[model samples]
Each structure stands twice: as structure tokens, then as C-alpha cells.
Target: MERTTDPVDETPLTAEEYEAVHAAVAAAAGSRSRSLNSLFADWKDVVEDVEEGYSLCAPEFDDDLACRDALGRAWPLLPPRVRAIRRPELDELDGRFRAATVPWPGRPEEPHQWWRYRIPLVVEAEAGLPRPGGWPLGWEVLPFPKPAGVRVVEWGRP
Candidate 1:
């Protein structure tokens, strides 16, 4: 259901759609064996309005170096124009990494129009610390306990 000029057309998801989303989330959460990449690849189709890809960053680092290192690795995978937002409230001990893809000027028809899909990473921060061999430039070694939680929100024009 695409949104037109009318605000009423952009109403919240129907009960059936919500149910599907809930089911998908539950499935993702339960699949502890899958990696983060695999989880996103599997469920991206189930969730709607996810044009701007999601991200995962290390928030519970001893220093900014670790945080920046994680962000640098995850940045390339994110959709173009996406930027990181520091979320301190999500985890007071380690904070959280949030990346958002903002619509470019004049591209109102893109997915950034009225709604956005959010997928949260359920990471085991302590387990993913830099190894003695050195931290790789990706999340392959990161301990992802389960697939990310998903949600949709109406975030009108920036």
C-alpha cells in the first residue's frame, strides 16, 4: 500500500499485516543460530518499507576507538546517505549504534517519504570484543544472539 498525497492513505498497518510482522519478528528472535547478515537477508522480504538498509555497531566499547572501528566496518554496508545516530538510552552501559538513511533533496518518491523500517541488532557486546589476532573490518566475529527486532514508523519529511 503506497502512500499518496492524502494523509489518510498512509494509515497504520492492518491487523493482518501487523500479525505477519509480529510473526516474522518472533521467528527472527527465535533463530539464534543465524548470523546477522543471514538473518537480515532472510527476513528483509517479510518486512515492508525497508529501503534504507539497517546497521549494527559496537556500543559497549572501552573507548571510542572500538565504537568507531565498528561503525567504519558497518558504514559501507548501509544504504547511501545513511548516517549514524548515537542512542544513549537504549543501553546505558554501552549505549547503542543507530544508522538512518535520509532521503536526498528532490527524491520525495523514494522510501523516505512517509515511513521507515527499523531493525534492531541484538548483539552480545562482550563476546564480540577485538580478538588477539585483531578485529576484522566486519561483523563476522560479532556475537549476535538473535535476529534483530523490526518495526515501522511514520517519520515524515526530514
Candidate 2:
């Protein structure tokens, strides 16, 4: 996705929506932010880190989950000003990478983009974070196929 000039949604909120959101935010205790600071040390403290991680993971799901999970958690916390400036850099860079597979001639299953399969959405949508629209959403987990000639390794078997 090409980064826009402004990352935050600029559409104005209705008066009722604005009041309700303001009240909810105002009531939220500072304790929650403090606790996140104390416990979530890996939460990106610098905007540069979030931008860097976003660029890295955009290419494809990394060999492991660390980059994906990190992005999922830190993305919501990023400030709009930073995203406005840094997100555009992506247009110059490669488009977000997608790892996809095609259906076989006889395989009943449809083509699958086995991306973001196990990553956690630690920050839920209510937090107002902008999640990637293309994430593999509905299926919680995909059934992995055994490779040709590679038998399933059972626990405790040599």
C-alpha cells in the first residue's frame, strides 16, 4: 500500500462521535499507559523503529513471527506525524511482499496466501489502530501440508 501524505484519517467525526470518543479517552486511566510502559519494553519507543519494522515486514512474512508480531503491536501506538513523513518512503521501496500459493490441478482447497497466520493482534481493533486490510483474517490457522517424502515426526520417535 502506498503511504499517504497523512496517516491519520482526516475525516471529521460527528459531534456525538467526538463527544463519546473524548469521554471514553478521558476516563481511561493513565495507569494503563504506565503499565504498558513498564511491561511492554519491546513496544517501539522511537518512531524510526516502527517505520523500520514496517518496511522490513512489508516484503513478506519473515522466516519467523517476530517481525510480524512486533509490527502488529507497535503500529497502533505510532504517532500520525511520523507516519505522514515516513510512510511515503515505501512508494520508493518495494511494495509490501505477499507470499502466496496457487491451487493444484486436483487439490480441493483454494489458493492460499499463508500470511500472518499465527500472529497475535495483541492490540484489538477497539484501540483505533489501523490494521492491514490484506491480512489473512477469518481462518485462525491453516492446515499445513507435509512435504513430499518428509514423514511427520512423532514425539519421542528417533
Candidate 3:
């Protein structure tokens, strides 16, 4: 008798399975942005010591332009202790301008390139400030994979 491995019961995935696969692909592609931020944060404490604040201008998609503008508008509203740090020299330095093209599908081809600038601010001592939680739309938490591609991950906090 010939022995053969049970054909692994290969079957077409159902609708739910298809959706899951789709989500996983999208998450993988979007994870890069979050990964970059996490890497930067790891070194943030040291950077913060050198300057009161630091900022990064990460190019944003056109859809996110509103969020970027919102941040810019909010900057001036911050207290004096919280200053918007601008380094014209560092502007356009990261080269994160390209629109997302893979892993996630159906995204606009003409997504505007917006900049993500981060500035450090002192959390005011005053007790009366809106609680820090829940960012606006377009802000999402996604898993970041290891650089070596040796592992997989699930939805993660940003």
C-alpha cells in the first residue's frame, strides 16, 4: 500500500477568512509607520535631554492632511511651556513622502504628502486639562513586526 500524507484538507477560505486575510495584509503594510515611531521613541529620552522638545516631519497621505492641520492649529493653543519646535533644516529630511502602495489595497493614488512633526511638551501640572486618550480618525494602532521578519504579531498599541 502506498502511504501518502493526508492532503492537508486544503479548502477555500470562507468569507470571514478572506476578510481576516485582507485585514492582516493591510496591517502589515501600515505597520511600518508605527514601527518607525516606536524606534524613534526608544531614543526619545536621550534626545529630550538635549532639547526641550524634538519634532519629526513625516510625510502624510492627503486624507490625513486635515489631521496634520489640526495638530498645527493646536500647537499655538498650547501653553508657553509647550513650544512648537521647527527645524527648517530637518523638514523634508525623512523622505517619508511616498504614498502607501502595498499590503493595503484601494487607497488613493494621490494621497497628499503631509508632514508629521512631533514636539515635546511638559504635561502641565494644573489639574484641569482634557484627559489624554482617544486620538481622532486616521489614527490607529497596528502591530509592528520584528526587523528580521522572524516573527508575527497582532494588533498593537501605538
Candidate 4:
């Protein structure tokens, strides 16, 4: 994953630096099973000591439930018109239809490209957006120029 601006200081850390800080924090915490707040404090201190304008971003998730919870919390902060569409199966009729109609001569043929399918229901809003939460991480959020035939299945927050 690319380095994102630290939410606290808006400073970016190289991937290596980020990993090092995480390692340091883990070592400090030992096996005490510290709360996230304490762990974040450890991370903040490490970053502050080495790099003045940097703080760790949100920790990565290890489970779907945790990812969904994070999404729920972050949902209301998203920009307007952001949409969360479920992954459409390529074997489905609509998926097949979309693949046939969408012209992409240079598009790579790979399983990871499943998002290439036509998204049928687009839920637009500022929160509750789906993300690539599991192994073989996929789209964190859908990209623009959404599939040509997507319908506004629902609008606003649920």
C-alpha cells in the first residue's frame, strides 16, 4: 500500500519507516494486550521522536467485522456522492453482459480485475462505503467513471 499523509500531522512516511514504527510499537507493548489508545500513543511517541511531522494512520484490520466497524465509523466523513458497490460476479449474466459491452482492448485479463464487472446497485453517500478488507486486497473504494449502466439503487445514508 502507498504511504498516505499522516492524519495527525499531514506528513507522509516512507513504507519502510512506517513498518519500522509499527515494529517498535509492538516491541514496546510486549504481550500485555494493550488497548488501541495505548498502542497509538506508543506509535505517536516513536514517530515524534524520529520524524517531527508524522503520526501513524489507522491500523490495518485483521477481520471482516473489524473492517466493517471501521467503515461504519468513517462513513459519515466521506465526501458527497461517494458510492459503495458490492463486487459483481463475472459469471453472472449482468457481469457477462457488462464485460461484453464495455470496450477495453488493453484491459488485463486477471482475477483481480473482477471490479471490471458492471456494478448494478450503487449506494451513494458519505459513509458505509465498502473496502477491500480481506486477503488479496481489492478496491478500497470504487474508482470514477463508474460502469456505464449502473443504477442509483439507493441514495443517502441508511
Each prediction's number of clashing residue pairs: 0, 2, 4, 1
Estimate, for each residue in 1-158, the C-alpha lDDT of model 3 and write its tens digit. Answer: 11223342234335664444334323433432332223223223323421331122112223334333333343344332222122221132222221111222223333232232221121111223222222112222212211221111112234
| Model 2, span 24-127: residue lDDT tens | 32333222232222222332222223233222232232333343343334333544443344344422221222211222223464223223332221101222
Question: What TM-score quantifies how close candidate 2 is to the native fold?
Answer: 0.26
Residue 15 CA error for candidate 2 (Å)?
32
For model 3, the superposed segments whose C-alpha errors exceed 4 Å read 1-60, 84-158
lDDT of 4 at 105: 34
What clash pairs does model 3 have?
Answer: 58-116, 60-114, 62-111, 62-112
Error of 2 at 61 (Å): 7.8
lDDT of 3 at 75: 34
User: Which residue ranges in model 4 land beyond 4 Å of their true spot?
Assistant: 1-106, 112-120, 124-143, 156-158
Clash pairs for candidate 2: 58-97, 59-97
Worst-scoring 10-residue span by lDDT in model 3: 145-154
- What value of lDDT does candidate 4 attain over all alpha carbons? 0.30
lDDT of 4 by residue, 29-69 (tens): 44334332343344333323222211111122112123223
Q: Residue pairs in steric clash, candidate 1?
A: none
